[model samples]
Target: MRLTFLGTGSAMPTGTRAQSGYLLRHGDETLLVDCGSGVLNALARTDVGYEGVDTVVLTHHHLDHVSDLAVLLKARWLAGETDLTVVGPPGTSDLVEETLAVHEYMQGRLDLTLRDRTTGTFDLAGFTIESMAVRHSMQCFAYRLQPADGGPSVVLSGDTEAFPELIEFADGAAVLVHDCSFPDDVDVSNHPTPTTLGEALAAAEAELGRVYLTHLYPHTEGRHEEMLASLADHYDGQVTFAEDGLTVRVED
Candidate 1:
């Protein structure tokens, strides 16, 4: 399986990174997770473009995470694509409905389906997937996926503060894309600072493979080394900041 970071920035744009989006490709299956503000063009830059993707998995309803879902749909519709499946948490149906309501022209144009996963394991494309609730201002989930054909497990932590449950959920995975939204000096709450995230990882002692820090805010500018050092102070693991267009092969 291969993972591509399409957008790694937070609500605030830095031009260098888009919002929250990722592209996952395994065998012939493709899944887009959390299409944010600039992700449409970001997707366009990928080899697959928007046409090759037929499914999107959203982690939460925040604007920075979901802003470009409609744009993707519109782009696909314009290209004569007729079907799309958008899978998300409990409020997905309402989210799609309300979104279409706002853009009345898009209603009934495509065979758009919404799947809601509140808990438990489910199949997505060709992957066996599980999800867990994370610490966030709203109801959010971190997804764990293993390809049905056999591959290393990959975990995508949406937007959450560092906690045992999130770490435990990602335990043993080959890769974890977690939110490290700011440096230790930011004094954040919902999102994790380097110290908080490192503390959480250290406390759990889970073998979380190579963890990638994402969901960066502009405040993280020019301070990547210091932030990484801060996280290393508590959790001694291979951690690095994720950037847009960064592709990583998920393998042990």
Candidate 2:
């Protein structure tokens, strides 16, 4: 399985990074997660075109997470690729309907399916997806994707605060992509700092293979080294900071 970071920045766009988005490709299936602002443009920057995305899994309905959803759908509709599936927690269908309603021009032209799920495992495009609720200001989720054909699994932590459940969700996975929004010294709510995330990982008492940090904010601009050092203090594991267009493969 290959994971591509489309946009790794937070709500605000930086000169280097965009908002939160990712593309996961396994075999011939492509699943896009979190179509935030600039996500379509970022996807265009990659080899995958808008028409190649057949499945979309959203973690939450925050603007930074779902901002590009309508645009992607519109583009796909224009390209005549209307067969699509979007899965997320409860309220996903409602949000889509509301978004389309706001943009009446594209309301009746899209043909897609919407699934609203909470905590369970389901099959999609030959992959088993497991979702778990995470601590956030809004209803959010973290996903674990296991290939049905048997290979290394991948876990993605959406916008969340440091929580032990997330560690368990990522246990034994080949790759664990988590949200590290700020540095240790910054006082923020509903987002993980390196120290808190490291402590939570340590408490889980499980082997989470490799950690990739994403969803960075401006406060974390010059504090990458300090954050990594703080994270190392509580948990010693391989960790990499995510960047837009970064691609990683999980080996079985």
Best by TM-score: 1
lDDT of 1 by residue, 1-252 (tens): 999999999999998999999999998999898999999999999999999899998899999999999889899999988789999989987898798889878878989889988977888888888988888999888999888888799999999999976898888999999999988888888899999999999998588789999999999999999999999999989998999999999998
Cα RMSD (Å) per model? 0.9, 1.1
Q: For model 1, what is the error of residue 211's alpha carbon versus the real structure, in angstroms, after optimal superposition?
A: 0.8
Each model's C-alpha lDDT? 0.91, 0.89
Q: After superposition, how far is residue 156 of candidate 1 from its true place, in Å?
A: 0.9
Return the clash pairs for model 1, or none. none
Residue-level error in angstroms, candidate 1, position 204: 0.7
How close is every model to the real structure, measured as TM-score? 0.98, 0.97
Which residue pairs come into collision in candidate 2? Answer: none
Q: How many clashing pairs in candidate 2?
A: 0
